[model samples]
Target: MLNFLKKNAALIWAKKHVQKAEEFKKNAEKNQDELLLSLVDTAKKTLFGRTYDFENIQSVKDFQGKVPVADYEDLKPYVEKVKRGQRDILWIETPEYFAKTSGTTSGSKYIPISKEGMPFQVKGAQSALFHYIAKKNNADFVGGKMIFLQGSPELEEVFGVKTGRLSGIVAHHIPNYLQKNRLPSWETNMIEDWETKVDKIVEETERENMTLISGIPPWLIMYFEKLIEKNGKKIKQIFPNLQLIVTGGVNYEPYRDKMEELLGGKVDIVQTFPASEGFFAFQDDYTKEGLLLLTNHGIFYEFIPLEQYGKPDAQRLTLKDVELNKDYALILTTNSGLWAYSIGDVVRFIDKNPHRILVSGRTKHFTSAFGEHVIAFEVEEAIKSTVEKFPAQITEFHLAPEVNPEEGLPYHEWFIEFEKEPENLDLFKNELDDQLRKRNTYYDDLISGNILQKLHITRLQKNAFQEYAKAQGKLGGQNKIPRLANDRKIADLLKVYKK
Candidate 1:
């Protein structure tokens, strides 16, 4: 009955509003004010109203110069207030549940998750079906079992309570059939859960023919590596009917070559963009260039200039005035009752018609080590291109800056697990240097001077990263080994070899 209601409601809503969006797009310029008024008025009732200062929100939207930029740190007080079940700065009622953790950026940012909020995740996640129906033109997903590598189901109490993050909540709320059968029945539930426990996963996969796989990119890569190691050209021997692989949480390009090599071909892959704050968007079409924004349901969208976050003179943009192709930091006003909350992600509109967007990078994750701003994608590209120059294959790799207080230069130390050691380590390093120089000019400038940006390559014994992750309590059953660490201390935590 619940599923029926969900399907019918989504179908009815989509039919009405999708057409409304199309009609609005047809004469958006003419009906700009009217459309804006209608959207905000509806949003006021649906999202804002009693929780927030609706008049102030309208005033800010109307003023249009800039709004205050607030990170998780800034919102901590209010979020804590919500966690304690108090009337927060926004929400009139206490949130039903609180989202546990943020991603790799900050440790854990607890956010309010209402019953209203969970539906967005459900609807957004279900859009995968819509993607198949609309784009791939396939209706049924009655394939083999799906492996969703995420965080653990059991919540670790910080003080004395059980408040696991979104993953736990998601696990709790999954459809009964899905919950009963689809997941890997190990100790760890998600990628974070599986990180520490690969042997059990390998054993599980050996038994079952996994057709659909889902996880963060790094964990998926790690899982595939384990599969290859155990089976040895036996993936086809075991999972002959393996069809689709869905992944998110990290960038895909860096591991593309490695993943392809492991899979023996391109695994039919789907990338996802999900956050605890909101089910912001998902890849809708086959081209997979950008994700389609979930325009309605529970959230109100707003964009503020990336350059102006926290600055005095920053301008905020509404649905009515977002420009195309420009990078803007995201601020979400949601039914969970977060008003103008900065999710700390940066996205750019790739298309204006259906509001397609590309997630450029996180504002916090970018590295300016030695003043060379290298994003996750940029570093991934550099690593991929660097390895392509070598005849020997790279199994796993991690990058980080070797910061020395006594020394002047900041250099990148690469911890690489290889199938076969390269003949000339110097030559291999030179090739990587050349690739970085060609691909990232900022890196080149930093290295070309008196400061020698040395690439230290540590050849790992077979299954070294896997071993290391296991040793650090980060392997097999849901924990992930860091692919790129910004500093030496963090790198030391994950590195298999020191010198």
Candidate 2:
């Protein structure tokens, strides 16, 4: 009777939310201008608002003209003030907490999370699952445990505000009724050590009926490895009822084959684009190629073309102005007080009707030092192709420019940790080089001109990335090995583990 009631309630919840999501899409399409104007008007009372003269801004053009696109460094002072318990600094009031994320080019970032902004994050997550359920026409998974392999929820107080990982904060706010179906209790989740937490999770969920799993791909892979090691069975064998897998943070293309191999069967995947700043997008339709942008959410977005990213007087465009297939660096002006914030991510719009996007790469995570611009998507595709052709699997990899004046010619240095090493390493390296050349015309041109030499592949010892991440205090949850770097910072660090 209890199980029946729970399942029925879950169905009702999903049904209600699915209708709201549809309504939201319709409303956004019809009233985008009105919504943005309302957002500006609502925020006009805040500190950032007052300083920017939001009260006088009558249109998107005026708002764009008044506010400059800002990176984290530009807003750090305001964030610091909020950290010290200052009120009415950026938002109407101080943030309820801050989410600390490892910055790519910069150091640690503290993103403000206001009370009003919290619901959007929660609703975004819930709507993602609800959309999946509505599309697949199956809510049976809700009756079983859904494990979210995430960070610890135990927050460290920054002045009066509680700050922690965004995932941790979201985990702490999971609806009370759904608590019965969630795995790894609060006590287990609060464990600081990732390895220890994984052990405890394996122990706790080993016998449970785990139907759904959600997390970043690498950490999910780690958990699966541990589970298989303990039980001597594949994931599907262990959890016969397992139905869906949702992943994001990094591109899922590279990890797809490996994950399927471990699961022992085809598992449905739903991708999401969740950041500490806000829950931006989610895979709404299984048939669709890109994630549907959460338009009606509390966040307002702008985009600058990739070519115009660092250039002064670059065009900052709103949703109405974006073109399909062009790469654009994402900018956000949110309810949480991020005014025209450049969040460093680049994306391409695939559809405009419902606003679907494909996350292409990061602003700082590309290589163009030698005029051979290589984005993360291109690199990832090349890696995927190389792995498919060879009998090798990459555990982790990083590519950096080798541009020493003393060296004869500039080249891309690939530092790779392989799970299954190819019998002929030379062939593997050549294949990777050929694949990348085929994909990127600029890189091919440079190689043809002899201005850039062929890629140099350096094989690192097993578990090198894990050791490096541990050393940097960034092992597990959300933190990832940056696949491409413009400089040799990551390459230099990985040099210590060269085989």
Candidate 3:
């Protein structure tokens, strides 16, 4: 009863505010620079001398380029201070919740998320929703049960804290009005609660009349595949109204074809960029090539050239100063208590009016085993192109790095699952390897130097990737087999099922 009330209330509020949100976007775009600067000033006042090293940053004579580049590590001192209950580190007005991010192998980065921080994320989320509404121009369709496959409950002191990283934070801010009947009750929490409630989560989602679903691509893909396997041809028939499918957290271009095949339709996937710090952008319109940066919300954006991150004299430019089509590393200052924070994402301006950006890839999620650095986006594109050339139906794929210890020759081994046997498998592999070399100059250079071998493609029968993921204990919802693994050790772990 409470959930129902929240859903209806949220819908009513949305009906009243959707137009204004659209107007806010247009106005923000028209007066981009002034609004951005004003927001930055507000952030400085709200966070400076409180949550971060504001005086040190403000003291820099050349604020643009003089301030040193910061990774997540740079903020550790401040976070540690906060964790230790030091009153001097921050002056948080109304402390609410902290959002955890998937940290680098070690632990997790718990970012303090406040109520002030939520409005911005809400804006981005709503903007994406408005875009979806505008696409079909069906404002009435917003009234339905939306199920977000996010994190589950975790032990927090005496009670189980219901959350998981970004998904958890998103869940946390699920406007007080939208919590009742409109929201699906099932939680696709991460590995934290998977051991006990995996079957239960599947049962709840399968039972609920879930109209809207949003999650990371790999997880959604795995879930739908599981549904097909479990229910046979009755899968799609069960969730006929499950229309809108929103995803981010990974690149979707390479997996789109496979996902469409599995889901049985071209599901609307609104790509978004949500980090531990804040929600950055969302695809505002269906046809747009890039996502609209939530310029008016929680974040103040800054960009430096990818080549200039480490340089002592690299200029950190604002939105007004960015060059379109050029790759730049994103540095953000957000209302969520993070200042001049480096989110480790690389983006390029795709549209100017609405300030849309294309998230190319992560700065460090790359392979440089052969001196030729192949970023995630490049490898994904290469794999997609290679898969398309084959006449056989490709089910799933993974690219693993192969580095020789003795001779130091490095190359990538491709593992693929296909529906049928290819006519000329060897020739196809050679052509794909040639395509990779031609597309990436670094790979070609490594090939010429005898440092990288020609690509080796191995085709597995259907469900190979799924079985591999299950073996890794990454089955059920929200778990996916990573398309690219950087090291041979991680690669071997991912491919332990190879006979």
Best by TM-score: 2
The digit string of per-residue lDDT tens for model 2 on 56-86 reads 9998889988988899999988888888888
Better of 2 and 3 by TM-score: 2
Off by over 4 Å in 3: 1-62, 87-91, 139-141, 153-164, 182-192, 195-198, 392-400, 405-409, 417-423, 448-451, 458-482
- Cα error, candidate 3, residue 16 (Å): 7.2
lDDT by residue (1-499, candidate 1, tens digit) is 5545544554554455444445534544335444334434443543234334344445444524322456677667666655554553345455666667634555676777766677877667766545644454432333356676546677654323346767666776666556644756736454454544555677776668576777775677667767777778645556776666766665666666667767775457776777778787777664567777776646666787765666766677766678887768888766776656788677889887777887766666555667776555555666677667776667677777776734666677777877656688788888877776776677887788746566667666777776776676555433445565566654675554543
Model 3, span 1-499: residue lDDT tens: 6545544555555556656666656765345455434444454434335333343344222334333556668767766565554432333543345566556643676676656776676667776776676565553334455666667534242112122455655665576544663443534453354434435545566766656777776667556666676677443465766667778777777767767777775456678877657788888776667887877775667788876776777777777678888778888765655656778788889777767788876776666666666666666667667667876456666777777634555668877776555689887788777777776787888788777778777666556766676676665444445555566654665455453
Order of the predicted models by TM-score, top scorer first: 2, 3, 1
Better of 1 and 2 by TM-score: 2
Q: Candidate 2: deviation at residue 244, Å?
A: 1.5
What candidate 1 gets wrong by more than 4 Å, as runs, is 1-53, 59-67, 102-108, 139-141, 154-162, 176-181, 186-198, 302-310, 315-328, 348-350, 392-396, 403-410, 419-428, 448-486, 494-496
Q: Highest lDDT among the candidates is held by which one?
A: 2
C-alpha root-mean-square deviation, each candidate: 5.5, 2.0, 4.5
